[model samples]
Target: MALPKPGTPVRGSTTGRPIMALLDLLGRRWVLRILWELREETLTFRELRERCDAMSPTVLNQRLRELREADIVVLEEPYGYALSKQGRQLLEALMPLQRWSEQWQKKLAAKADQES
Candidate 1:
């Protein structure tokens, strides 16, 4: 599927809200892992593939293309691929979600313990 662009209809939505578009893109497999791998350092194509073990180069290529189209990732030749400014901001935006997931994990563990 094409990278969901703002103002364009995306999966599960007709209104084309930016949030929905974002979700559609991020919902794709390996997209988040790519972002996370590039969070701290720029990596070459091979390096990125190594970081995301088991991810086929074909899929990575496609995801990178989509991310670049979305302005989330950029090619910084000599060094390799890196997150664009907006990509960094997007990662920052996801921090809250990470915290929530951690909290949710703890809650689930507690519930499991209670049932034990």
Candidate 2:
């Protein structure tokens, strides 16, 4: 499958706005998990698969291929798979969202506890 890119049609938006393209790619099953796993360091295919709860090899391979095509992941010599420069930047951009999500979760949990 062709990876989503700006200036071309993407799943959610015909115009393929940059953010839409990114979301289209990230929306695929296991895509975010793969990126998250690679956030810290490289991992061999086996190690990554294990960390992902032994996901089907076919899906993992497909996701990795897609990530590489998007320039978000790269395979280094003897180091397995790691995030590329752009990927790191992407993670940096997401840090704020992560913090927000944690805060949101806390609020939700507190509300639930109060209800209980």
Candidate 3:
């Protein structure tokens, strides 16, 4: 399905602001995980499913279709599946967030230890 355009209603935002629409799409279960798994190399459907801890094939296929439609992923002649240029750029933008998540994970662990 074509993604909802900006200014159209999205999952959480009636205004469908671009950012909100993006968040809505990215927030879907396994979406980010799929993107992360594809960061280093193209993987076939089976490989991706295995990497994703055997996520149901149906869900994986659905997410893949959506990503392809969004121009965030493409299937190469023999490369299986890889991120498109826009997808790579988006991953680059998310790098800082990934770094922050590592630190946040540490902080959470420390807090849990203190409580324990």
Candidate 4:
């Protein structure tokens, strides 16, 4: 299939297949969380799920597959999942987002306290 150029209409899937497909992949259960768990250290699948508060095994496996396919994660020598170099780069790009989330979470908690 010819890929649509930027600003051109995407021909498949109502919301435009490319963006929707990306979002769909990202939106899978525990996908981002799995990557987040690997931010600092690699972990076996079992360990990853434990860190993720016991995410479903099936879902975790699926996310791992997708992440590996996207080259954002790799199964290393010890056979544990670790963020790929590309994934580390992506994480660096999201450092600002972490700061924003910290601020946003505090604000949200303060708002909740005020409401209570």
Give the alpha-carbon lDDT of every model.
Answer: 0.94, 0.94, 0.92, 0.78
Task: Tell me how candidate 1 scores on lDDT.
Answer: 0.94
Worst 10 residues of 1 by lDDT: 1-10
Q: Candidate 3: deviation at residue 20, Å? A: 0.6
TM-score of 2: 0.95
Residue-level lDDT for 85 in candidate 2:
99
Clashes of each: 0, 0, 0, 0
Give Cα distance to truth, residue 75, candidate 2, Å: 0.4
Model 4 Cα lDDT, one tens digit per residue, 8-114: 44444455565655455555667778878999998998899999999789878877877888788999978799999989987787789899999999999999999
Better of 1 and 3 by TM-score: 1
Q: Give lDDT for model 2.
A: 0.94
**Which residue pairs does candidate 1 place in steric collision?**
none
Can you write out model 1's per-residue Cα lDDT over 57-79, one digit (the tens) per residue? 89999999999999999999889
CA RMSD of each candidate after superposition: 1.0, 0.9, 1.5, 4.7
Off by over 4 Å in 2: none
Q: List the residue pairs that clash in candidate 4.
A: none
Instruction: Name the runs in model 4 displaced over 4 angstroms.
Output: 1-22, 111-116
Candidate 1: segments with Cα more than 4 A from true spot = none
Highest TM-score against the true fold, candidate? 2
lDDT by residue (tens digit), candidate 2, 11-116: 9899989999999999899998888999998999999999999999999999999999999999997989999999999988988989999999999999999999
